[model samples]
Target: MSIAIDFNHVVKKYGDQAVIPGLSIKVKEGEFFTLLGPSGCGKTTLLRMVAGFNSIEGGEIKFDEKVMNDVKPSKRNIGMVFQNYAIFPHLSVKKNIAFGLENRKTPKAEIERRVDEILRIVQIEKFKDRLPENLSGGQQQRVALARAIVINPDVLLMDEPLSNLDAKLRIELRNAIRKIQKEVGITTVYVTHDQEEAMAVSDRIAVMKDGYIQHAGTPQNIYHRPANLFVSSFIGRSNILNATLFATNDKTEIVIHDKHRVVLTNIRQELIKSTKTNVQVCVRPEEFLFTSDTNGLKGKVQRSSFLGLNTNYFIELESGETVEVIQESDIDTLIPEGSVVYLKLNQAKVNVFNEDGSVNLTEGVKNDAAGEVQSEVNNVAI
Candidate 1:
């Protein structure tokens, strides 16, 4: 049966050096949860902790209601897939998948039945007779996947499983992995530094930095309403601009570059009550619209690149800052360099940060599993 996994105040150390100093998060049952961050951010360390490969120093790790702190790696009933395809070189594809069942002393007929079923599930029935060395990289990964899931593990832990494959194979295998995980209905914890891969397959993501979780939410939530400045810069490309927030009576507005004025309607009430004035604004490239009106941010296009569906423009603002803007490709003509353009921002979609850029002032940001607000915003019920 699939089970929910929980980490509460988990700590890890190497001699006297602390690596993960108390972390917490919950993975839902039968859900695909991803740990996303740059290297040395403790994503793989936390995954190992869950799999019983690394020892926990404090708090508790739980699979449903059972504490797993003292459990052995083999006793955890979990399957792990790594970046390097770790299949047996000597075993055929079918034999590799049937290894786990045979070790458990299953009936001979049952082992053959299960192996055939899993071969078909992973779509490697045709390659069952072939050895690992004879299969393609993609096919070898399928063998690894089939071997891991043929025993019906309670949970699946994958650490950068697709990081070794080429771009095209990565997409193909990721789609297959997601489909198979859903079909088998097993809870999964996946770790990767690739933001796009996390966003593509995860039901939810936990963005971590230096052993701390920066933000945890759906891909749409994290991309649209990031919890902090770091998360805003990490998830995707964005342009940061210095701005001033002024509240008078019941209205609040932000002034950018001492010229552009944007009225904010959905910001939290606490921000208006605070005495802060200076703020940072995060505007995505797609959020900027080229306007013909005179009352807009004036800029000159330096260069533009045509990227199939969208064209990217590098514009130099009058204040000497350069920003990237993306617009739909026009079949008519491309805007020439040195052409003066006015930009109007989509006020409703922009994220505003405080002076230190530590917390997001935008509303509807959700809290991580630790129940603490990573940003100064209203909690969104997920």
Candidate 2:
């Protein structure tokens, strides 16, 4: 039975040092939740707290309203998959998956029934008799996954389970893990530093920094309408530009490079009411378009690279700051280096942040750290 997980101002301490001060988040039943951030950001520390491997100093960690702070690892009934495959080298794939059930003293016939079913679920039936040494990296990871889920634990905890595999194998196994998790319908808490992997696998992601959650929402919400400048830069590639904001009644206008202008009506009303100016703008690589008209930000192309579906250009703006621009690969010749180009901003998609890069002033952005998740995924303007 899958269960909901909730953290209520949870705190973790290692002796005198408090790694996680107070963190709160929610994971719906059967939802794939990912904790993503750079190293030492406390993502792993929080995951350990959930698995009962770390001591909780304050607040509560609950699985469906049942406090888990004092629960032992063995009594928690959770399955863990680590970065390194922790399978027994001497045991065959079949034995590795059935080891848990055997320890519980399950019937021999029931063990065979469950083991055979899990082998098929992980698609490693042919290698059931093979030892861990004989299997490939991807296959060994599959064995680890099969072992973790065979017990039908209430929750599955995976900490960078694919980090040890090659790039191709990582992609393959990530997709496989997502598929298997969905098929089994187990609530999972996945931890990783890989943003792309997190976005690819999670139903929702909690971006963490310094033991605090910066933002928590669906992949689209985080990518298209981030809560702050830190989240904007972390989840994907973004070009941060300094600009001035001016408000006239209901409409807001932003000027870049003292020349190019963008008018918006959907800015947060509070910002307009307060007449906040001198802000930072976050424009994605694909949000800038080349235009023949003079009413745009002027830049000189420095270099261009063709990456099959999209071509990337490195351009130096009039202010001498370099920015990356991505456009669809066209049949025409590539924009040569040294060519002056006028770039137009997609006004609807560009995000504006306060001078400190702490709050997003764009309309429809929640800007809440530990508050409720975005109820609407398509909060960005169309």
Candidate 3:
């Protein structure tokens, strides 16, 4: 059975410091939800509250329709996997997984059956008799997961469970966790600071800052259409160009760094309607194409680094502003440092931001640009 979680106006504080304040969110049944943020963002605190490990100062937490604010951790029926694989060194893998069932006073036959089932589910059954110290990091983590899920809890809470493993092992274990979750169809809430991990695994992510949520959406929406400046800068790499709104009767343009101007098509209509004082143009590194044509922005390459699949160049514009550009070409034909090049803005890929750094570009604008880029993709394919 899957569980849905609802957090309504929840608050947590330690004396005068508020870890979470008036926070509200809902995790759908059987969904793999993630709370993503930097350290000290209150993600772990919120997870603890849901597990009944932390007290809620205000509001309430609910599993399905039952209020959980006063519920004890044991009564919450939540299984938790922690960062450190908290397995007993003395106990073998089978005993570790069976500990939770033993605590609940499960029948001897039932406990053995369930423990064997979860061991097979996590694919670590071969090492059931081995002690934790004898198992690899990944093997031990699987044991920890088996221990948590053996009791068949309604909700599973994982607090950076992959943090202790090496990078390769982290990916391997995460994939295993996702596969098992799908097979069991259990409701899960995973908390992590690693952006790539969150992007790869989450059905939806809530990006938090300080004690509040900055934005909550699928990976695509959060990456492509961030709600604010903090989110735009946090989710991924972006080049923020300071610009001013220059509108004319027929069109609108932005004066970049007071030296150059770029015409805006679909974005112009919205900019002309806004009353904000400042504007910024956000361009990804891959959006700018290098051209030999004189009409584009003039820049001198300052440094270039080869990154296997792509070459990254640091280009200094005529106004002394530095920007990074990524190209998928060989380093042999590299634009050497101090070599002049022209950079053409792939206008369709650009995102405009208001003074507060909120993405002002609407879906209509994106669709129009996608229509234009569709032909470009086809031409490349041909």
- TM-scores, all candidates, are 0.96, 0.95, 0.88
lDDT of 1 by residue, 39-69 (tens): 9999999999999999999889999999999
Candidate 3 per-residue lDDT, tens place, 1-382, comes to: 8989988778899998888867877899999999999999999999999988889999888999999999899898889999998999999999999999999999999998999999999999899999999999999989989998988999999999999889999898889999999888889999999988998888888888887777777888777766555666777778888778766677666777665667777563533554333587777899889887777788999999988899999999888889999999784687788999998778766777666564455233221111222233223210
lDDT of 3 at 84: 90
Cα lDDT computed for each candidate against the true fold: 0.89, 0.89, 0.81
- Can you tell me which runs of candidate 3 are displaced by over 4 Å? 247-250, 265-277, 358-382
Q: After superposition, how far is residue 296 of candidate 2 from its true place, in Å?
A: 0.6
Steric collisions counted per model: 0, 0, 0
Tens-digit lDDT track of model 2 for 1-382: 9999999988888888878888888899999999999999999999999999998999899999899999999989999999998999999999999999998898999999999999999999999999999999999999999999999899999999999999999999999999999999999999999999999999999999888888888898889889888899999999999998887775688888787789977677654444547889999999999999888888999999999999999999989999999999998779999999989988889998877777777876643346322222224221
85 in model 3: Cα distance from truth in Å?
0.9
Residue 202, candidate 3: C-alpha displacement in angstroms:
0.6
Better of 1 and 3 by lDDT: 1
Write the candidate numbers in order of decreasing lDDT.
1, 2, 3
